[model samples]
Target chain A: MNQILVVDDDRELRTTLVEVLEQEGLQAVMARSADDALERLQQETFDLILLDLVMPGTDGMTAIPLIRRQAPRTRIIVMTAYASVQNAVQSLQQGADDYIVKPFKIDGLMLTVRLNLQKARFCEETEAADLDKIFNGLANGLRRQTLQLLSRQGQMRFMDLVRALEIEDHTKVNFHLKTLREAGFIDQTSDKFYQLTTNGQRAATCLSYICKSLEASAQARPPIVP
Target chain B: MNQILVVDDDRELRTTLVEVLEQEGLQAVMARSADDALERLQQETFDLILLDLVMPGTDGMTAIPLIRRQAPRTRIIVMTAYASVQNAVQSLQQGADDYIVKPFKIDGLMLTVRLNLQKARFCEETEAADLDKIFNGLANGLRRQTLQLLSRQGQMRFMDLVRALEIEDHTKVNFHLKTLREAGFIDQTSDKFYQLTTNGQRAATCLSYICKSLEASAQARPPIVP
Candidate 1:
């Protein structure tokens, strides 16, 4: 489970935030002060830290560098009741991933938290050149359709896949299948049944999820009847 | 609610499919044959249709064109037990969005359904040049971060956003903000506070969701220990 550290001086707010984070299926730990947060950070790594800008001692600004030094990969989201241009600028420069004004809606806060964690993970995963291979495999519509077909069927033979894909060019289908196999997204059995590898399954799932979200977003917008 | 019509001669499979679709938060209606499916199309408009290929009467292949003529917008997925290269090609030529081999995993089926719906909706929403505008607005990391910030905070003042963004160059901040506003992603109040427009919020949400899904995919893969 992804762990988050929530640091705030107000006991009530801290408790509420922790509860909400836990409800969202993340492990939440609380710290009453920046000093406490820093101490906790030294003990274990956290995926993210929700830090309050104006704590009692060692304000969020002061603790930013300390937390970065302790867990460089941990993303920080700074919250401030007295939100200002200067503070926002300072926080971002201080290595904070984002800043939220106090009195934020819970839904908005959750979105921020989720997005930051994703951004951090994306950076980590793409730190190498493997992303290039993944992109190459997904570059063509035919290959993507192939992934979609395999994702549904679990495993299939080459001829059936070509038929299901409805594309008549046999050589094109062969080329795309070879590319996917070389990218480590698929494996062909001795009997000639092709199935997605673990990486392929994850990639296909992500692609489907993204497409769904984009559609939902578009639907949520009011239709512009021209 | 998105409504789907499932047509299959196999009563048990149709029931299982309806149950699964309902479980996934969609309204599913069933039909016994291609004739029955066409009747349902005339009675009610559906977002999607799942057609079985090789049914007893008015088989799937014969019904594809009739169904498309009746409801051109409704995306169709053709399912077949004897999936072949010819069947796949014929299905696409007949206007099917995708096809799945019979005996598919329920999870894979759901993914296909979700992706096709998304693809259909995306095409509808992007029928004009609006998509290019949205992409242009999202082209810059700084602009995307700006959207992320606004999405979380609801609104912010000019200088505060600059501070939060941690960029020292005023001209750059001004440029990105102008780009967003012109692209219809944001609005500026008379008081100089900036907030995302409805479209902006939807786009931002979609971006966050996609990023999160991609990260999840990356995490699911075996770690490449460097």
Candidate 2:
């Protein structure tokens, strides 16, 4: 038996999905609000989660990472009526397994749901294989250094940032910072002060420790799992 | 050598793409107008065609079947800024090999082109696999038929349509239509007129045809591909 959590503010849409998923022999849980959805996540695990983007508060974007933490094994599929390439790409970047546009076929929807599930069946095996690999260590080295410095210093000024890094060009440093900000790893204040946000700090603290300790193991990694 | 034709009214994008694809070692060709593209098609056989949906004169939807019939071996990939599941599914049904949402990563664009090319590579070894087999078959069933009929007819009155199809209840058909319209397949003018437009027709036609043929083929040894 599979459990699917559907979180959408639209009562009719949410309820309809519950009925549909139920017909498919999956225990479909409906959450009319993101807060309620998060509460459900804390209580039990789901096989898959269907999240709606336009919600009142703690919208899909904010909820994604938390859901990733709570139900690390569950595949998350984001649904949005206001579909854009930027949004789709961003959702995929945020670790969503797949996305379904609002106006979709019963067949296309079912196909995506089925494909996600089938893909999930073998995901962990491949994920484990990739998690055992190296190569990206050198690629992410500068970003890690930025994170580490931020964690140790609490906050860093824009001008001081450029001087400390080996890179001389301010433009290159700014590019890296922009990438970090976009990826939700760091934040910049109005004063041009760069610091980790609550979520960013938490992730950084945990990830930094893991990477630091696993530096040698990182070097010995094999080919990644696609 | 695989000849890749890029069709777009935008000179800048077309120029950039030709440079990019040629740099990647592909036999790239560009057409500013549908007429020009047809002319190019006559002079040479391309392995792939990249089309822009919103264009002056004949757009992607209008050009699809023409290209499909003219060069059955050629794969078409549609590009659009507006990314909808409806369009994605429709383009697939229209014998389009794939789609790339606009303002996309150059990498994503290249990867999709390469991936489709790679898949078509096997089509040479296997003679029977037509675009219909690879794109749309019986994946959606009645829903595809509903979309196709609506697309081809341009518009139909709801009550009259239900009677024509001999559906028992009006609400069920209406609900399904709402979903289809939302998916961008069908558009209703005022309360009475429903039209198929380009996006709607593409997805509806081929999918509907493939499904009916499959059903018809079930009793036979196998469905013959033509």
Top DockQ model: 1
Candidate 1 Cα deviation (angstroms), residue B169: 2.3
* Sliding window of 10 residues with minimal summed lDDT for model 2 chain A: A130-139
lDDT (tens digit, per residue) of candidate 1 on B1-226: 7789999999999999999999888889999999998887766888889999998989899898677655655788899888754466557545566778888999889987887676666755553345345545655668877887786566899988999999999789999999899889999889989999977865675454344434534434543221
Candidate 2 interface RMS: 23.6
lDDT (10s digit) by residue, model 2, range A1-226: 6678899999998898888877876688899877888788776778788999889988897787567644555778889998865566556535465778897777787776765555444443333332212112112546656765676566899778778777888998888888777666689889879998654553343332222121212223342222
The local lDDT score (0 to 100) that residue B215 gets in candidate 2 is 22
Q: Residue A200 in candidate 1 has what lDDT? A: 84
What is the lDDT for B192 in model 1? 85
lDDT digits (tens) for residues B61-120 of candidate 2: 778756764555577888988777656655654556567889888999988887667545
Model 2 has an lDDT value of: 0.64
List iRMS (one decimal) for every candidate. 16.4, 23.6
Residue B73 error, candidate 2, Å = 2.6
The second chain of candidate 1 has a TM-score of 0.57
lDDT minimum window of 10 residues, candidate 2 chain B: B208-217
